[model samples]
Structures are given as structure tokens and as C-alpha cells.
Target: MNLYTFGKALVKTALTPLYRFEVTGTEKFPDQGGILLCANHIHALDPPVVGMTSPRTVHFMAKEELFKVPVLGRILPQVNAFPVKRGMSDREALRSALKLLKNGEVVGLFPEGTRSTDGVLKKGLSGAGFFALRGNADVMPCAIIGPYKPFRKVKVVYGEPVLMEPYRERKASVEEVTAVIMASIQKLLDENSEK
Candidate 1:
């Protein structure tokens, strides 16, 4: 197996039991081509949880600080993660993500830009929409629930892909596209909560 696949297997084996991990709608993930996986950020585990459960290999946009850690810096890139400066638009990171999408790779991002301390869905930054529009990629809304305690059930749900074609062609405002993405993520969370 490739490095990413091997790492994913190792993570799944190690954490699935501890987190009681569950995943759904993985079939909704596209088998090929460029796509964006936009998810809500809660805990630090959110990225790996979503990434491992996804059928497609996801190159995640992670905070730049994480890359500074000695060990993480070396390992994250091997697993398809690139660093992004938070609280501002990092053009270099944007360019990298765009290039990945252009190559028909899946890029994962948290629209909220940062983890929510309260676990509440927050307003998304415009970057997600910007990438979707520019890359002509479908945005897949994903929700990750629970794992609040060790061995507690943690679920990852992937919603239908939101086609960017309509918004892209109409030149929709960044706010509009971002709103749609946030709403979709919220809806997924809401639905999962009811279960």
C-alpha cells in the first residue's frame, strides 16, 4: 500500500476503537476528479477523523502553526497536508490548494477557518467559496459528531456534493457561496444531532 493508504489503515485501526468511530455517506464522495471536502471544525481530531473516513485521498489545509512542530512538520506533508496561515488570507496556501484541485485531487478544508471552542457552527470564511469557484470543483459538505469522551461514538457524515457550476457561472458573491456551504454543513450537523 502507498504511504497515505498505510497511514490511514494504521490510524483507523488505532483510533476507531478508542473513538468508536462511525462513518456514513462515503459513497457520496466522488471516485475521481477535483472536489472540495468542507467540514466543521470542532476538536483537533476532526481533520483525521474526516480524512480517514473519506474514500478519496484528501490533502488537508492545516494551520501553519501545526507545521512548525518538529515531528508533525515532517509527517503531515507525507500524509497530504499543507500549512495555511490562519486569520488571514494566505496566498501561498491558496495557490497550493488551487494547484491540487486543478490536478483533480481532493482538497479538504474547514470553512470556519478555525476550531469552534463551543462546538457551535460558526460563519465560514470566503476562502472555501473562492477555491470552489476558481477550481471549478464540487464542494462536499461533511459533519463530524461526538467523540466527546474516549470510547464515545464519533460519526462522520458526508453530504451530497454541491455543484459550483451555477454559482460560478453566475459570478455569485463570495458571501453567497460561503453561506450556502455553511448552511449545508449546519444542516448535516442538525440532522446528525437528531439521530
Candidate 2:
């Protein structure tokens, strides 16, 4: 097996005891074709957690700084991660994601662009919306619920794919798609975070 698969199993096995991973709504996720897994950013672990819970390999758009962090820098690429320069339009990163999606790969992204220290959902960035529109992949909204508490449940909810058909048909704006993504994530958190 590849390093990505091996690491995924290893992480899951090790963390299962420390945290209860309750994943739901995976049935709503598309089984094939390209997918953009957009989720709320709560912590640094969110990307790996999302990767493990996904039914497919997730190519995460990580921060550029992460790729400069010694061992993590080298390891991130092996695990299907690419760097994105935040705060401005990073066209290179955008092209990379679009290429992956065009080739029927799953790309994971945090709509908020960075981790939320308070574990609250932040406004979705238009950059994420650009990825959705340009990639032409299934825009699958996701949510990772709960603060990092030892021995507590870390719930992940994958909401149904956003209806990008109409958006694509009319060539809608990026902000329009961002709004839909944020709302879907909020809905998932509201319904599933209680338990």
C-alpha cells in the first residue's frame, strides 16, 4: 500500500482510543468523479481527520508555511497535500487544484482558510468559492464538530453535495457559492453537534 493509505490507517488506529470518531452523512458524498470537500476549520488536526473520514483519498490544499516545516514539509506532499499562499489569490495553487479535480480526484479545503481558535465557523472565503466554480467538481460541504477534548467524541458530518448546476449554468459569482457552502456546514453542525 502507499504511504498515504498506511499513514491513514496508522493514525486512525492510534487515535480511535483517544477520541471517538463518529462520522455520518457519508452516504451523501459522491462515490465517484471529482469532489471538493469543504469543511469548517477548528484545529490543525482537521485536515488529517477529514482525510481519514473521507471515503476517498483527499488532496488537501494546505498553507504554504506548512510545507516549509522540515519533516512536515516533505511528508505533506506524500500524503496528497499542496501548498497555498493565503490572503491573496494564489493562481498556481488554484491551477493545481483544478487539475486534480479535472482528473477525478478529491480535494479537501477549509472555507475559512485558517483554523478557528474558538471553534466557531467563520465566513467562507471567496477563494474556496472560486475553487468550487472552476474545478467543476462536486462541492461536498463538511463539518468537524467539537473542541479537542480527550476521550470525547470528534464528530464529522458530510452534508449533501451543493447544487452547483444552476450556479454553473448561469456562471455565478464566487461569493454566491461561498454563502451556500457556509450555510451547509452550519446546518450540519446544528443538527449533529448536540450528540
Candidate 3:
């Protein structure tokens, strides 16, 4: 198995016993083809849980700083995580994500751009909307429910794919598209819980 698969297996092995990680709405996920897994970020663990539970390998956009860390930098690439500058428009990161989508790969994005310390769903960045509009990929709204604590049940809910046809082949602003994606995510958060 590749590093991502092997590592994901390890995560599941370790986490399943420590925390009851539950995944639902996976049947709603597309079996193949390019797709975006846009989720609300609450913890550092968000990315791995989302990636590991996903039906496909997810090429995630992580912060540029993490790549500078000694061992993590080496491992990030092997697991399909590219880095992005946090504050400014990181063209390099955008290009990497687009290329991956063009090749029919899954890309995970946290529209909020950073972890929400209080676990509240915050307004998402327009970058995620840009990806949905620019790439020929289905945008799937995802939510990570529950706090990341040992022995706690954390759930990853994959909601229905947000339809982007109206915005496709047209001139829709990124913010407008992002609102729709965020709304979808909100609905999932409304319906499910960690309990």
C-alpha cells in the first residue's frame, strides 16, 4: 500500500480504540471522478480524520509552516498534502490543488481556512468556492462533529454534493458560490451530532 493508505490504516487503528470515530453519509460520496471535500475545521485532527474516512485519497492544502517542520515536511508530500500561505493569496497552493482536481483526484479544503477554536461554523473563505467553480469536480459539503478528545466519539458526516451547474460555464463570484457550499455544510451540522 502507498504511504497514505498505510498511514490512514494506522490512524484508524490508533484512533478507533482511543476515540470512537464514526463516519456516515459515505454512501453519498461519489465513487470516482474529481471531487471536493469541503469541511469545517475544529482541530488539527480534522484533516486526517476527513482524509482517512474518505472513500478516496484526498489531496489536502495544509499551511506552509507545517511543511517546514523536520519530519512532518517529509511526510506531508507522501500523504498528498500541499502547503499554502495562510494570510495572502498563495498562487502556488491554488495551482497545486487545481492540478490535482484536473487529474480526477479528491481535494480536502477547510473553507474557514483555520481551525475554529470554539467549534462553531464560521464563514468560509472564497478560495474553496473558486476551486469548485474552476475545477470539473463535484463539491461535497462535509462536517466534523464532536470535540477531539480521547474516548470521545468523533463523527465525520459527508453531506450531499452541492450542485455547481448554475455557477459553472458562467461568471459567478467566488463568495456567492462559497455561501452555497457553507450553507450545505451547515445543514449537515444541523442534522447530525456526536452523541
Candidate 1 per-residue lDDT, tens place, 114-134, comes to 889888899999988889899
Q: What are the Cα lDDT values of the candidates?
A: 0.88, 0.88, 0.89
In angstroms, how far off is 10's CA in candidate 1? 1.5
Q: Per-candidate TM vs. native?
A: 0.95, 0.96, 0.96
The clash count of every prediction, one per candidate, is: 0, 0, 0
Give the root-mean-square deviation of each candidate in angstroms: 1.2, 1.2, 1.3
Ranking by TM-score: 2, 3, 1
lDDT of 1 at 50: 80
- lDDT per residue as tens, model 2, 56-157: 999998889999999999999999999999877888898999999988899998988778888878998887778788887879989899766899988999
Error of 2 at 66 (Å): 1.3
